[model samples]
Target: MVVKNLIQHLAQLAALEISDSEVPKYQAQLTDIFEHMDQIKQLDLAAIAETFRTTEEENVLRDDIVTPSLSQAEALQNASLTHDGFFVVPSVMKDKDAT
Candidate 1:
């Protein structure tokens, strides 16, 4: 539904053709939205704090402790170039000294 008539409706809602100058007017709507959000925040949330959505459970979180991974030699066995116990790649610095 949105993809259809999106081009036609945009000019009507925006009061101007979609172009570089027209973008800021749409972005300025955010200021009006933040003003409304400020009004909602002023209300006392101390007592009537219920779960905002139907779900009331804390997000079950996993422990952040480390998980084991493959050993360095095993991981680097297939690399194109490696030396001094580490993977190597092409140097990003331009070789300006080369003639």
Candidate 2:
């Protein structure tokens, strides 16, 4: 039995804000989902064979062949910024010392 309080608690844990009017709506939906899961648990399927795939088609893969490609200079030709043979981008991480 999914209750309104439980739904509100779940929303809090997930960092979601729900209105007072939405609590009962979520509670009913969650209760129905749980009931369906419970019904699935009651089914007996011990004789059924476990299957990893439903389709008969097998994965077709191309042969791995090494090919000659671009040089270091060619690869970094279009970069907006380059430093010591490496592409220099803006810093993404914040400095820990600068609080």
Alpha-carbon deviation at 31 in model 1, angstroms: 0.8
Q: Lowest-scoring 10 consecutive residues by lDDT in candidate 1? A: 1-10
Error of 2 at 73 (Å): 10
Q: Cα deviation of 45 in candidate 2 (Å)?
A: 0.5
Query: How does model 2 score by TM-score?
Result: 0.58
* True-vs-predicted CA distance for residue 22, candidate 1, Å: 6.2
Writing each residue's lDDT as its tens digit, candidate 1 over 1-99 gives: 123244447665655457656556555665567778889999898998677877667767887889899899998999999998899999886554477
| Candidate 2 lDDT | 0.89
Best candidate according to lDDT? 2
lDDT, candidates in the order shown: 0.69, 0.89
How displaced is residue 3 in candidate 2, in Å? 2.0
All candidates: TM-score:
0.36, 0.58
Q: After superposition, which runs of candidate 2 have C-alpha atoms over 4 Å from their true positions? A: 61-99
